[model samples]
Target: MEKPNSSNALVCELINKGTREWNINNLNSWFLPEDREAILGIPLSSSNTPDRLVWAETRSGKFTVKSAYALALEEKVHNTRADCSDESAGKIWKTIWQLRIPQKIKHFASKAARDILATKSNLAKRKITPNGMCDLYVVKMRKQSVICYGAVIMPKKFGRIAGSGVVIRDDAGEVFAALSKKWKSPLGAIEAEAKALEAGVNFAREVGIREAEFESDSVVICNALQGLVSPPSSVVNVLAGIMNEVSYFRQWKFAHVKRQGNVPAHLLAQHAKNVEDFVAWRADCPSLIEHACMQDKM
Candidate 1:
């Protein structure tokens, strides 16, 4: 009989002690019942042979790199359960891949949505210093005339405020749409600026302007949108909502200009102060803002 090796040392000791003949009662102390049964089931061979390791995965009892890799993958899959069964996560990824935007933008947006991108907040959480800057690579296309929208708010007395303006114009300095409205409550200038931006973007969407640019004179609001500075905690949610709206655009950008360039919107906002309710004009320039719009175009 072949001598048992280190793997079966207890059995080898018994075999060396002239106890080669085995029975369940003799083997019970040294072997598990199932192991003993397996040993007993093997047919004894008349020819002597050396004991060798056998790989049960293959009929030839030899290991292959391919089989080892497969086994490792199986073990890994069995251990990682959280990511295996997530249905919505896969769907969201597929949707992002199918969007018509640039691949780089899609990639950035997807990472941002998952909160996994290297944003300042995420870096701070990992105990790393944030760069405090955002680098966006904008692809400049032919400078086609784009529809522009602007907004402004005015304050009044007795803790009551009125006047908000929205102006939309084409590249030729023609105002296609203009709005003036009065509000019942007072709002801070920054809050009013943000509200105006939201309203203007919504109006552009409503009017079927898929590709457009929006300009605001408020440097603070513009900087926040470009990721240059963090908005106050009070307005973070508002900024997030505006960003969500921006995602709907196929091509869009926000610009910060001198107050001189934003005169039309400013003038309309001032015009709102005297209005009782709301007024809007379409397909024609408002007499009040025509010169202001022309100056901006110049």
Candidate 2:
């Protein structure tokens, strides 16, 4: 007769061992004391010299028995139950899965994990880091005479585009969309961007909206928004005022996008720059920005 495979033999050996309160301590040594007790209960001490002990650790900073051996003991318990019939053996086997479910959930950085494991052997040379940056495309343009900035919004549904936005606030709160006017100089760009964010946040807040994500291509505005440095005199006080108004939001994230992607906002702003009097909305959009919206529909 052919020899039995090691896995099958091991299963059979475990079945023969049976559950007479087997050494759970060794199987759970890796888990914390509370987790160990939660899963395995207290160990059954024995006076006999032959009784064996072993232990292991768990992620929650506790010690428990080695998991595989505990699984072996659980398998033995179900196998030796007399009332469990031969035809019901598969059902009994499924019970072993219950013990392993929790242990299977741990996540790790895979490429880095492989690199570290490779160092323990003589097989490979490359050390890999599995982290990458979020690619940002910023499009900036003139609508009428206004300079606008924009970045794409990722949609909840996959493979789709949501609306985009111009960064109105840097450190104030969540990102929002708004209408802005054209500025001829660098100082103009900074003040205009800050005002746009303040306008957008106030509009959103009036409607009870909270939390937002904002992005911009202007490094000057971005750095100022983050409070990494001061904005020029024309913009600082307004930026600070906007921050106070937006302080109720849960969080705000500022991102920098490249200029090529900020086109839509640029178009809106360019249109707004020429208007004599600004109304926050025209047919649900700022009247100054209506031309840009109409052009987009076309």
List TM-score per model, in order. Answer: 0.47, 0.34
| Model 2 per-residue lDDT tens digits across residues 218-270 | 67666877888755444444555566666777765555556654444664544
* Model 1, residue 201: C-alpha shift (Å): 0.7
How large an RMSD does model 2 have? 25.2
Score residue 177 of candidate 2 by CA lDDT: 39
lDDT of the structure predicted as candidate 2 = 0.38
Worst 10 residues of 1 by lDDT: 135-144
| Tens-place lDDT digits, model 1, residues 37-94 | 3343232211122354554334333667876786677546534532325888778767
> What local lDDT does model 2 show for residue 84?
39
Look at candidate 1 and tell me the lDDT of residue 124.
Answer: 40
Per-candidate Cα lDDT values, in order, are 0.54, 0.38
Total clashing residue pairs per candidate? 0, 39
